[model samples]
Target: MKAIVLAACLVCMSNGAEYVVVVSKKSSFGALSVSQIRDVFLQKRRSLGEQKTIPVNVLGHDEVRAAFESRVLGMDRNRLNAYWVKQHFQGVTPPLTQPSFESVKAFVENVEGAIGYLPGSMVDAKVKAVYEF
Candidate 1:
């Protein structure tokens, strides 16, 4: 299952499917470091300064989600599962999930502190992209 998902992500990347991390256009935050972005997604750090940061995840076994996990979070399935389990034990939780890139974009646009990742081509003026990979 992991191999299949990786293959799909590779195919998308080979076809010029660029992915980026995006935030609300109104957000005061600027470009974030990879570690900072990682912390946000992993729920290690909640707020970006004064604003309460809300991390959004791509739903299900999505290729984009897989890429984000591998390339951004640097976690594989087993590690991710264990991480989540530990978080659950600690009474913490993972980020919210969005069904699609469009939904993520819309959610980020409307919510001041929301942040998410999606295909770069789908980004519009409604949100500002902070990182790309």
Candidate 2:
């Protein structure tokens, strides 16, 4: 049992697949706690660290996006689809879904009140990691 647990942890750690959620280095939000992050993602909180929040999503299907959904939002693709489907017509959509991390970063950097995540290697000094999952 211990070995299995260790293996699972190792699997999660290998490459440390996830870094932290980041925004442009110019952002005022340097870091965030999990609950604070959850609030922003869920649209429950209007701001973080003196800046309004805009949470963006990765489009349709991407492996890293999948990780963000499951690992971060605690929701599966099906649930996510259902969620968007429900939000689509309400004139509300789940963030502006982007095709890649680059786009997300661009959006965040260009716009205030924006937040998104990319892989660790993709993150540079331009963006500051707000939270590490």
Candidate 3:
């Protein structure tokens, strides 16, 4: 049990989900404030230009989820889990979750008003990372 625990911890530390806030390279929208970014990620957005904001997530068990919670929302895992539970009961689904970074980038590129984070290595011509956390 201890070994399993230690291994999981190691994996968590080493394989955090890496992602960046993306914008269309053609977009004139300038740098977004932390509060604005948070609002988008938290589904608190009113609009992003003509379209709305789309918040994307990685897998439920991914390290990026925990890292993003802490870095973006200042919430820890247990608290975030509780938050989702409450939101689900309230009929408010959280952000869309992709199984891999590749899917995240693809979603962002194909969808307008859509912004998401994916692994750093998955970046390409389709999107520009405005911020990284």
The best candidate by TM-score is 1
TM-scores, each model vs. reference? 0.85, 0.76, 0.73
Per-residue lDDT of candidate 3, residues 32-125 (tens digit): 7777877776666747667677788777777766776788778887887788788788777788888877777778777766677666656678
Over the stretch 1-133, how does candidate 1's per-residue lDDT look in tens digits?
Answer: 9999999988876765488899999998898888889999999999988988999997887888888899999998689989999999999999999888889999999998999998877878889888887
User: Ten consecutive residues with minimal summed lDDT in candidate 2?
Assistant: 11-20
lDDT of 3 at 90: 78
Over 1-133, each residue of candidate 2 has an lDDT whose tens digit, in order, gives 9999999988766756365688777777766877777667766577875678889876778878777777777889899778768767776556666888789888877887788878777777777887766
- Tell how far residue 95 is off in model 1, in angstroms: 0.3
Ranking by lDDT: 1, 2, 3
- State the weakest 10-residue window (summed lDDT) of model 3: 13-22
lDDT of 3 at 37: 78
lDDT of 3: 0.73
| Cα lDDT, all candidates | 0.89, 0.76, 0.73
Q: RMSD to native for every prediction?
A: 7.2, 5.8, 7.7
State the TM-score for model 1. Answer: 0.85
The runs of at least 3 residues in candidate 1 whose Cα sits more than 4 Å from the true structure, single-residue gaps closed, are 1-17
